[model samples]
Every structure is written in structure tokens, then in C-alpha cells.
Target: MTPLAISANGPRESYGDKLVLDGLGLEVAEGTVFALLGPNGAGKTTAVQILSTLIRADAGEMRVAGHDLAREPDSARHAIGVTGQFSAVDGLLSGRENLHLMADLRHLGRAEGRRRTTELLEQFDLADAAEKMASTCSGGMRRRLDLAMTLVGDPRVIFLDEPTTGLDPRSHRTMWEIIRRLVADHGVTIFLTTQYLEEADQLADRIAVLDHGRLVAEGTAEELKRLIPGGHVRLGFADADTFEVAVRALSRTLDDMPRDDDALTLQVPSDGRVRSLRALLDLLDAESIEAGEPSVLTPDLDNVFLALTGQPRTAVDPPADHPVDPLTEKAVAR
Candidate 1:
């Protein structure tokens, strides 16, 4: 078995009256991105806090980088980094200074800290803005700096709680690229929680959905999507007669099929399995139905999220007062 980078065995947490996390369990492998998703009131943040040693779990075992979180909290903390939903960069300090501060907190000596700071500044492409105040940098630049600061300790696992919350589409993609490089090149395992369904679709090797403190679903994006019955194969016909014929012919094979009279299209529910699609095609051929071609519409992550969480996936917009590039704003408008 591949050594796990992080694991939580039935971890639970609760407040006086409200239960936050209820027997949550997870296992993430090295160099893979694992995403946890939930609605606003779900315990996504609480999970990250517990896993990273910021908060203690009410019960169960937690491990990071081979260290038991309960027995070796300090060792576990040293091997993991955390980037919260909000930026931790100080406005008054320059980008380089911010990196230096993180290095100092990690107990790196002055000479080694400067070397690590310089290396990270160039790696994140922040060398040009290294001397400028972090607050003056663009949203993307600030995010890169914030992430760079997280690496000061050279952690094997990083917990990112909505790391790209306020970023524009372009910067959102940039963050994705950075995350990929971290896994592919640096062998870092990522534990991410994000509001963007697409982000999880594009990045995570595995995804788990939490609803009301319980894990409702866990799988790859396509696997979760397959669990929903929203997929259908639309058979388009040339005329009303053909449409009716196809519908009648398909009705014997599938139930609750939806059809459009005006458009001459018949939709057959599918499980997105190849055998099902091939069976439908074989049936059409046997009946000589001549349903020109079929257009398959499978459930996307949006549909999967809604089905599992009982809510639509919503983008976390930047604060209203924040400045957005005209192009970024247009992308958001879409």
C-alpha cells in the first residue's frame, strides 16, 4: 500500500449545543490533491483546523506525515502548512519581508532564511515585486506571496481552506497551475476545501462532500456525477412520425423518458455506462428507427454537487469594494 500522507479515522467535534463534525474519516495519499466540499455552515473549516493542529478533535485518531496528531502534535505541525480562506500577508511588509518573517517563525537562521526567501521569491515569480509592499501587489501576486509564505517550513502536506476564494477566473486558473506543480514537481500533498466545484473537478484526485457535518459522498468527480440519474441520451429525429416511433420503440426498454414533440427529440435516461448506450443504439438498429444521432448529456459537477449536498454550487465573489480588472469582471459576469 502507498504510504498515506494524511488520515483521519472517525474524527468528531462538537460545540455545547451544535455538532460540527460527526465521525468524519479521510485518507489522502502522498502527492495527491484531496478536496472537501460543503455548504457555508458545514464543518469544512473545522476539519482543516483539527487536521493542522489548530484545534483538537473531540474524538478519534488523526495523522499527518506519519506523525500521530494526538501524541505528536508538534511533529505533525512541523510537517504541515496551512493557508486559510483569508490572506495572511501583512500589508505593511514587503513581499520579501513577509517570506523572511515566516522563515523566522519556523526558526530558520538569518542566512538560511534569506536564501529560502530569495529562492521562493523567484519560484513564485514574485522577484520583481519582492521589494514592494505586499498590499500593493495584484490579487494574483498577493496570493502567490501568501502561498510562498506557507512553504517556508518545507512542509510535506499543505491545508488550503478556500485558497482561491476571491481570485478572478484568470488568477483562479493560475492557482490551479501552481497546485499542480506542487504535486507533480515538489511531491507535496494538498488538502483543500473550496466553494468552486470546478476547482475540485480540475484539481482533486479525490473529492468528498460534507453535508451537515456528515460525509454524504466521496469519489472522483465523474464517480460522484455518475451517482446522479440526470444523464440522458437525446435521440433526434427528422420528423414527428419518426420521433413518435423512436419514443414508442424506446419506451419498451426504458422508463420515465422525456421527449420534445416540437424538436423531434426523445431523451432516454442513462447511467452513463457504455453498455446502456450501446444497448440503446442496438435497439434502434434492430427496429430500423433511423434516429439520426444521439446526443448524450451527462451530469456535470454542478448537478452532482446539488444532488449530494442539496444545494447548488455557488462562487464566492470578491468583496464589493475590491477592485477587479475589467476583463475579470466580465468573466465573473458570465
Candidate 2:
């Protein structure tokens, strides 16, 4: 069994009278991406802060990197790295200096710090700008440098809050590849919160949706899509006779199966799962009906987010009590 890198049960928090998190609980396995998604003010940032040891929860049991949050927060911090929505690069320092500063904070010796800084500079393609002031780096370069700083500590788990907010198309995809490699090559578990629903679909192994300080839904992307309506497999028929037969066969199994007489097609509610498609084929085989290849249509993550949250993913929430964690932005900066 894989050990859990992060876990929380009945974790609750409030800012004065505004309840930020009401018993929000979650578990994240080692070497996997777990994305926490929500509209603004959904306590997503609060959850990140609590789990990453930047803030205290009002009540509950929480552990990160196998260390209890209450008793061993420093130990947990040693194994965790955070890159918030804002860049953490110190504008005064060069990219290389920024990384070396982070390594020094991790207590690495000068030689090891230099070696790691050099490796990350090349890995993140920042070697070209290694000697340039961080303030002069492009948006993508700054984003890359920010993440490189996070890795200087060799953290087992990372919390990323909207890591790609200002990236362009090519840079966005490049960052996605880097994220994938981190899990596959380094076994680093990621806890990500992003505005892009497609980012979750592309990168997350599991997703948890938060609304009003509570979990609304949790599952794989496809599983969550199944929870919404308007998913079906459209089976086209050779003739009216076969269309009627297919609809009659599917209607018996699926409630309110739709059909188009003029188009000679029947729509059976099903997701993109292979087993579901195979079962539909078995049913057609039982009836000896010759239905052409079926086309499946299911709601995407955008639709799923809207259906579950009662608002679009980009919609802003009511005024939240979120304050930027300066330490999280620059965990090792002096």
C-alpha cells in the first residue's frame, strides 16, 4: 500500500466569524497529483496553508509528509515546498543567486548548494538568464525560476497555487510536461489549485471540489463528468427498421433513451468508458441488430465544474479573508 503523503480529518478554520473551512478533510497518496479545485473563497487556499504548515487549523487532525501538523510542523515544513499564485523570485538577485539562497536555507553546504543551483538552472532552462536579475526575466522564465527555488530543498510534497497564471500557450504546455516529469521521475506528490479546469483534467490523478468551505465532490475527471447530465452514445443505423430495433433494445435498459427518426440514430446514455460501450454492443448483438459505429459525447470538465459548483470556474466568490503568505511565497528568502 502506498503511504499517504498528506491527510486531514475534520479540519476546521475560521477568520473571526467568517468560516473558511468547515471540517474539510482529504488524503493524498505519495507520488500522485491531487488537485483541490473551487471558486474563489472556497477555502482552497486555506486548505493549502493548513496542510503546508503555514497556518493553524481551528480543529482537526492533520498530517503532512507523515508528520503531525500540531506536534511536528517544522518537520513537515522540511518535507514540503510551496509556490503560490504570486512569483517568489527576489527581484534583486540573479536566477542563480535566488536558487543558492534557497539551498542555503535548507542547510545544504556551499558545494552542494552550488551543484544543485547549477543543475536546476539547466533543468528549468534558466541557465541562459542565470546571471540576469530576476526582475528582468520574462514571465515564463520567472515562473520557471520560482519553481526551481521550491525544489532546492528537495521537498517530498509541493503545494502549487495557480502556477501557470500568466503563461502563454507554448509555455503552458511546457510547464505541464515539467509537472508530469516531477511525479514520474522524482516521485514528488503535488497538491495543486488552479483556475483552469483543463489543467486539472490534464494533470491531476484525483480532484476534490470545494464550495462554501465544504467538499462538494471528489473523484477522477471522467467520474465527475458522469455525475452531470447530457452524456450519451449516438448509434447510427442503416435504415429505419434497424434504428427502431436499436432504440427498442436500448430503451429497455436505459431510461428516456432518445432517438432521431429522420437521422436514423438512437442516443443511449453512456460515458466514454470502454466497459459501458462493450455492454451496449453486447445488447445489440443479442438483438442481432446491425448498428453502425457509435459516437460518444460527454460533458467536459468546464461543464462538470459549472454543474457541481452552480457557477463557472472563473466566477469570483464573495469577499474572502485570504491574505498572501509571505513565507510561502519565499520560504527561504532572508
Per-residue alpha-carbon lDDT of candidate 2 for residues 1-334, written as tens digits (9 for 90 to 100)? 9999999999987765677789998899999999988888787877887888777777999988889988998999999999988888899999999998999889999999999999999888897679999999888889999999999998999999889988998888988998999999999999999878999999999999998789999999889999888888888999987887777777776788777899998878887789989998998999999988889999998888888888533422222234534654211212
Q: After TM-score superposition, what is the CA distance of residue 64 in candidate 2 from its true location, in Å?
A: 0.7
- Quantify all predictions' global Cα lDDT against the true fold: 0.86, 0.86
Off by over 4 Å in 2: 252-255, 312-334
Cα-based TM-score, every candidate: 0.87, 0.90
Clashing pairs in 2: none
Report the CA-based lDDT of candidate 1 relative to the real structure.
0.86
lDDT of 1 at 150: 98
**In candidate 1, which residue pairs get closer than 3 Å at backbone N, Cα or C atoms, i.e. clash?**
none
Give the lDDT of residue 79 in candidate 1: 94
